[model samples]
Target: MTIFIQSFGYQLWNIITNGPEIPTKLVDGQRILNMNNEFTDHEYKLLQLNAKAKHFIFSNVDRIMVTYEGTNQVKDTKINRLVHDYELFTMLENENISSMYAHFNDIINALKGLGKVVTPRFR
Candidate 1:
């Protein structure tokens, strides 16, 4: 009985020492949100852009055109990648979120620089 108790105690100690693995996505999100001014700024911008992306993806929007703001529309093909990335980002709840957020922000920024309103559609 003493031997069995010692083994059980060791097992319990091991369990206490090694906790369950946390998903990387949660860690990345926490890291970005917890960082300094630059990331804070990105977080703010991301919130707005995320909202726009969500609406664009869910709504009846078709394509983005830069005619009024600039010259050419965001090509349909490129938009597919953006949409795909956004959808995957939204659907997944892991470490991919941080990377996806960065990529999505990049695309949004590029579109905005061209004077396009990112409804995910700019005409």
Candidate 2:
């Protein structure tokens, strides 16, 4: 499936940028972060580690939590989660940050907090 970067509806954008609510998934069984189809097989291999992670996004940051999924295998090599924030777009404008990806990674490392920040590449 093409991982939706952001919902196109104006309502969705409203919720994403200005809305106070953090995005969440259905509260059913275990939830998995799956964006494999968003990439080619080559890119998927590089980012395969994301399969075992849980991503949460709020405000401007996304935290990627690496954890065990259901009764499946466990993961413990990386930090709890990685964050990416669109607020970096502001930095881009100010010329404070260069590559968008690099700036986002820096923000995640610096500002990661208790239970805050998912989503990997796109959006």
Candidate 3:
């Protein structure tokens, strides 16, 4: 699970940095932090945690949340819709389990409330 999350995080970072055309699934959050060199200690920690959570959810749960904008605002309609679809897809793909769905909802809500754009490679 850790490896899965790490790989996903690395791929996500690469996608964000080098454009979304990259056919990869791992996003290296550490690389992103090193590349930016502007994130505060607390922010870096949070980013790492988010990366881990994303990796876990995507790899094991078979769903990914796509936010309309970056994570830096109150829960908007689009973001909420995205989350709903993501959870619904996960439920459909998996065994209709709701644990991961609940976890992702909490994470998305937290990110929406406290997450900043940091340095998105994508525009």
Q: Judged by lDDT, which candidate is best?
A: 3
Q: After superposition, how far is residue 123 of candidate 1 from its true place, in Å?
A: 22
Task: Report, for every candidate in turn, its global Cα lDDT versus the true structure.
Answer: 0.46, 0.39, 0.48
| TM accuracy, model 3 | 0.22
- Where does model 2 exceed 4 Å of error? 1-91, 94-102, 111-117, 121-123
Ranking by lDDT: 3, 1, 2
Clashes of each: 2, 9, 12
Better of 1 and 2 by lDDT: 1
Worst 10 residues of 1 by lDDT: 60-69
| Error of model 2, residue 1, in angstroms | 51
Ranking of all candidate structures by their TM-score, best first: 1, 3, 2
Instruction: Summarize candidate 1's per-residue lDDT along 30-116 as a digit string, tens digits.
Output: 632333443455455544554444454335233323232332344554666555554454424564867867767876765555454
Q: Using TM-score, give the best candidate's number.
A: 1
lDDT of 3: 0.48
Candidate 2 C-alpha lDDT tens digits along 14-119: 3434542322234467554545454566545434323212122432232112222421222211223332243423445555445766777665654443234443
- Model 2: which ten-residue window has the lowest total lDDT? 70-79
Candidate 1: residue 13 lDDT (0-100): 32
Give lDDT: candidate 3, residue 47: 65
